[model samples]
Target chain A: MEWLQNFLPLTFDRAVVWIGVLCTIAIYSLLYRENPFYRFFEHMYIGLAAGYSLGPLGVDILYRYWIEPIWVQGYWAWAFVVPFGLYLYFIYSERYGWVSRLVIGLLIGASAGLFFQEFSSRYLVQLNSTLQRPLWFSASNPDLTVGNLIQNYIFLAILLTVMTYFTFSYQQKGTVKGIATAGRWFLMIGLGAIFGNTVMARMALLIGRAYYILSDWLLIRVGG
Target chain B: MQPQTIWQKMLAVDRRLLYVLLLVNIVMFLLVPVRMPASISPPVQKFYDTIEALQPGDLVMISSNWSASTLAENQPQLEAVIKHLMRKKARFSIISIEAQSRDISYRLAERVTKAEGYEYGRDWVHFGFVPNLTVAIKGMVTDLPNTIKQDVRGTRVSQIEMLKGVNSLRQYKLVIDVTPSGTVPIWISYSPKEVNIIYCPTSVMAAEAYTYLDSGQIKGMVTGAKGAQEYEQLLGIVGLASRFTNAISFSHVLIITFILLGNVAMFMNRLAERREA
Candidate 1:
């Protein structure tokens, strides 16, 4: 028990980590063989996560939509939640599934309404930004400044080529064909880069896990 | 016996040998543990400079969205950023979108901040975890206290010491996201223009963020372990990130070299095949 606080001078986070490391190994053990240990931890994790989320999520709903405005700000009546409560019971049977449509409809409508508005600003803006030539005004010959210009051009080429390769148009002819082929090659290169980086990231994660198994669990107990 | 045959021999070298070479390279670098000060990229420098410019009593929002598995990259970045914020006496609040991050980042921040005399509720608060970053951001933008009603300790946000004045997200000067995920765009879109967004994405996430860095959407970025190493140098502390980057940088050089040799071998093998035909 004294050892649980062993992370203080160095980390001060032993309690959760002690449990989490064992859980991680349990989860990963499925790769070798399925056992009661993995399921026990897995279910416990899911249950804990569900329980943990309920309070904050409940607060978000109550504080945002109901309590603050009605009680503190003095905006509306408490009776407004009556219909909302009815909306939750539509799962009783197939016949009443349409009862829940009111809730689903609003959600879908909001999502659909905001889709293009949000996409245009976030994604389209990013797309437009990526299209700029790195050469602020063309670097001195091919020798180039080799800085933002190189960075910008690489981003633009990667984005454009990756987009083109995903285009499913079958009009394969001339420059379109050439562009498509180039796009395919560029996409392959991009994927290769992602794969390489992914390997490094995964290796880093593995190293962290190993440190936990060796240094954290064995050498010293953790603290929270 | 022929030049073509020699090329074929080189081309047919066992891939496991390359793997062994890499393992040796990484192991050797790890043992030496050189904290080579990186040539700070513009984005990383900007990230450092942003923290350097913070004034006392300034409020910042930190979204800690990474777990322990990302400790090699995200943990160091967060530590460095938190150190800066605390050094400047900038009161900050942390929120996590991931469940583990809430515990991991919050506890880690609490640990780091305590040494700096950062009193909970006064100088630093943890808002716990929330799913749906987009919806949460919108809510926080609209009503900060209501959206994040409780501190990680379960105290109301309004009751929290430093957060009493923070009615909405507009009050914060900066939103520094120390994450492996690319959630900066959400903050960029929803938050008020007054709030500057800095990023701390893992190396894989950093390349994509260069576009944002170029566009100035994100103030700057700390890329992976290398960025953390550069940050550690700036902080004058030797941490895990500095240690890991030795392995990473040498690995990068190794990969680049392999790519070059692979191309050369491919060309030679093509010549050999043609000659045989």
Candidate 2:
């Protein structure tokens, strides 16, 4: 702990405090108006991120999809080279833009095939299971707590009401209307919860930035 | 409509004021260090317990799929989990779907694991980023060697000392996912049924996971930064997650206050309309 305390030379760490203070000041300039310094870093952050992502991405695509085939598999896998070569030609010739579509089409097809199965298994199965639970099941046998029982009943209600809200099998009947009305209330609760969480998350981000300013910069120098 | 009250009028603060006040709260708290114990959510506790109970030499698969933006939350969770694994002497491998996570988690793991003298390639190997999680999982399931030709640095996976006997997901005792995305389902869907899958989702990502948590599809979860803190407590190590969550918990209280205030303002506005009518 003491080693870390003195790890940074006092002069060096003090110098760090100065730059941190300057950045803190620039960050507060965000309060006044958009300045070049702020915009510079903002765009630089974006550009750097894009560069980082694209660099690895370029290497991965060229290595896995192109170079590996040529180097490892040799001329036997050369058939893939033509379309791959064609996909790269769109930059030089506008007419070859359609060739890029072939690549896009394959991407879309693969995505669709995967997502179709995902959509069914995740969404459909979940929805169906929501509809089929036994309403009368006890939460606890001997060891089951009252809290467990209440949770089960609440789940049962939410399931039935929410499902009925989507039902359109026949003209609204008495039970159906009651269920639909219940679903509407449940929907309101759900929406409110979502909105609350969203606000919390937004505030969290702001807090993080403010933290960088006050704690990392100001407090560090002053407290030290 | 009801008559408007004075307190109710105050509730209708401007949206910008709400935002500024939030920024202030964050700034105020960040300057101060407060340590508060968290109410351990079931899933988070389960995640902690699982790692705590692991025996030495157990193999774990860690899928880290978050990036720098989520560093405030996900970084702490990754650090705590890795620290726990190191303490347990667990042999592990990390693989990522996102390219950034591959580099980030690799560096993070190397730093923490090195502190414990846990040798890389022998104890833990980073397979690094793959373009597709599903295809990778399928390949790792059916044929580990054919799918992953090389590690992140172009070394063969077969040759990596950590994965010497690890042919498939079935060989790993636990699969821990630290992500802010919905990639958990892919693991549940593709990984072998024999291996256990646990989760670490951002706080906002936790609610949707209750459905899976209830069904036992995911064995447990460490939710957001707070969950990371509880895990730190369980391990007897205070780290960044605990520090960050102090602000988060207080932030939760602040947001709740504003919501109530807003509702009060809306109620008053309705009452004023009634009175005018």
Candidate 3:
């Protein structure tokens, strides 16, 4: 044990950093070729993440919310909560399959109720904002600048075209067909933009790992 | 002897070699001591102004729900925001809906707050990790203390000096959500209307947030590392985002170049085959 300690980084923090570097390399090695080293580390990483979450779940959620309330605070009503949640596992039972549906039904009902508030609060504000957009310049609205007016017009046009594209109630024809085609083009452009951003996001995650190796492990100072 | 053509070689280049090239490009740029300035976007400016509007001793809730996976992007945003809040003398509390983020954000906030001479329970506190964000936010809207119950240190929120008279979420002035997840919709739906919201989403998540930004539901946004770099410029500080920006920008250039090269190679190969035919 003493020899092992001496062989490793002296401080716990440094040891953790070393372990992180090793794990990063092990995982990235798969980019070259599939191998046992990469496989082992990949599984280990997933397991570690899942295991790490249990600590917080136990301390923060279970003990703090459920167990403590029942045992210490004498909230007897809370005692049934865990067992009731456990009924979800009855999904595998041949005879007791109906037991799981109770939990599923309760969850669906709760979600449905919550979604009512969610839809109203979430969409209504957006609808109000969209409708309230000033299409043309007005003297009463002093804040409406030329730039804002133009932007609002562009926004209104795009909104109308996009909404028209999604209208499947009637077959599109003539000018409506052209407008729907324009909306489809607009949607493709939006999707392309999203794809570009997704690429940027993935690149950032890669750069982050590379930065870690250079700065933290190699002790190199990066850009200011 | 048929010599290999440049187009043939380019088409058949090993993917591993490309990965190595990218790695080297990133490392080389990272080691350079130069800094590139970022232009401030309207969303970032609005985000800065919203925080600047906060008065001293005003309460703010920081919903930090990102983990190691997004540390590069989210950390700089969180650091810059916290520094600005501390500068404003605003008392704040952090809560994490993500289990892994609990410890990560706690340690990060501790490091940041400690440097600014901020006291724990007096100036700021961590409410720790909660399992469900939607339910928690809804509950906190009605009863803050009962919903959160206690701080990370096991101190009852009612006893915390900073939380005095903060009976509900309505008492808070701002909710800054730094996340890579889709939790902003939940906050908008459940949190108090009077309290404004600022978003810090990863780049992939930012495009979808524009509608919300247009709707005024989210007052402002900082999009990923690029956005963080812009925010740091606005604050006149050189933070992680600035350090990581060069590599990010250069990497994009490299990827785009390879994409163009690949297309050109494909066209050349097809032409050569036609000539042979």
Candidate 4:
């Protein structure tokens, strides 16, 4: 038994790598066909992900923010925060469901209050930027060259047409319909660009898995 | 049934066969000894310049909110950014809203920083996972020490020598958001206006962020692994981004080739059907 153990010689790190390799193969096996092995790993992955989050939530959030403050720092008022948050679970109880709305109302109020600032900082800044762009070159805008001026004009045209496409208050007729059609074309092109980027993103994910297999598992020397 | 034409047969090829082809293409390119340098995009160049401008000991905040699902895209970006920060001798702290991201970024930063002889708590720190980004941002803006409370190591934020004078988000020179979510708007909304924000978004999120870039809300961006490759080129380092570049580039080419072929086959098959009619 001792001789066999010595000969095999599996370290903790190598075992981890082996398990990772197994999991990867199991997950990717679904590409061939749906099977029990794939479903088992898929379920295991979801369970592990959920369980993994609890560790951080406990250590980083509950311990640091809730428990430690009350116990160590003597911020006793902090103790109620979690219980209050947990009140949301009361929504499952028919008789006590009214208790849940108290938490819901708090959340909605906070979000609405935050949105006021979000609106000004987010959309207002963009609006200001759109209005500020120079359509043509001028001495005052010395930094803005002919190329930038042309680009700015194109941006303005796209912005207006896209907004026109979204306008549903009035009936479309003649020139308005023509502009809306053009807007739809522009939107299609924009969505196409986004879809192309999405493909690149998905491909990067696959390449990442390949890198892990070759570099980490197979012990091959990929580029730095 | 009528005998199928070559185009019709091509159109009927199994989907699994295409998946195998892509897998082969990626592995082949990944193992190729040859490396191609990427042309630097304007956003990546700006991202570099922003870090280059950082003075030694200038504090920076990193919002790393991506999990293993986006490891290929976000990992390279995070690593390149960390290396650049170390080179600039900047002090930085990482925060994550995604629970899984907290551990991944923390461990990745630990490995990278250790290699560079960057001391934890002194040169860099991790704030761990926050459940809510908006509340966390608002709290940090008001009172950083009280909000974050402690580092991942259990050291109080105020006790960390590197963060001695840092009591609010306003003190940080810059904020780098490495995420695959729309968390950037929250940062743009609530973070101190004085601190400049740069973004590293997965390719899918990159399109929506262009408006922010145009508005100068974000100083710059690094879009997924392709952008990371460009950044690695700018940094003159051959990190994971460099390794993955060939695979990503060639895979795109393969996809385009197959798309064109499929379209042609469909067109020819339609013509044949019309003739039969």
Best by TM-score: 4
Candidate 4 local Cα displacement, residue A151, angstroms: 1.0
Off by over 4 Å in 1: A1-92, A127-170, A217-224, B1-34, B249-277
Name the runs in model 4 displaced over 4 angstroms. A1-9, B1-3
Error of 2 at B201 (Å): 0.9
Candidate 4 lDDT tens digits, B134-194: 9999999899999999998999999998899888999999999999999999999999899
Candidate with more favorable, higher DockQ: 1 or 4? 4
Q: Write the per-residue lDDT of candidate 1 for residues B1-277, one digit (tens) a residue.
A: 5344665666777776776677676655655634556787778889888888888998899999987557777888898888889878899989888777887888788899888888998888888877778888778888988787777786878898898777888888899998888798778776777788999988678767766777777888887777877887778776667666666777768877888988898897888678879
User: What is the per-residue lDDT of model 4 for residues A35-119, given as tens digits with 9 covering 90 to 100?
Assistant: 9999999999999999999999999988998899899989999878989999999999999999999999999998899999999
* Local distance difference test scores for all models: 0.75, 0.75, 0.92, 0.93
What DockQ does predicted model 3 obtain? Answer: 0.74
Show pairs that collide, candidate 2.
none
Output the TM-score of candidate 2.
Answer: 0.82
lDDT score for residue B36 of model 3: 85
Worst 10 residues of 3 chain B by lDDT: B1-10
As for candidate 4, its clashing pairs are: none
Tell me, by lDDT, which candidate is best: 4
Model 3 lDDT tens row, A1-224: 76556445678876887999899899899999999999999999899899999999999899889988889899999989999999999999999999999999999999999999999989998899988988776777879988998999888888889899999999999999999998898899899888888889888888888888877766667885
Fraction of true inter-chain Cα contacts (below 8 Å) kept per model?
Answer: 0.20, 0.15, 0.80, 0.76
What is candidate 2's CA lDDT for residue A137? 40
Residue-wise C-alpha lDDT for candidate 1, range A13-92, written one tens digit per residue? 66566676778889766655689999998898788767866765566455645676688778777647757757867967
Tens-place lDDT digits, model 2, residues A71-143: 8867457556657747955756687678777767877888888786666645664666555544454553455
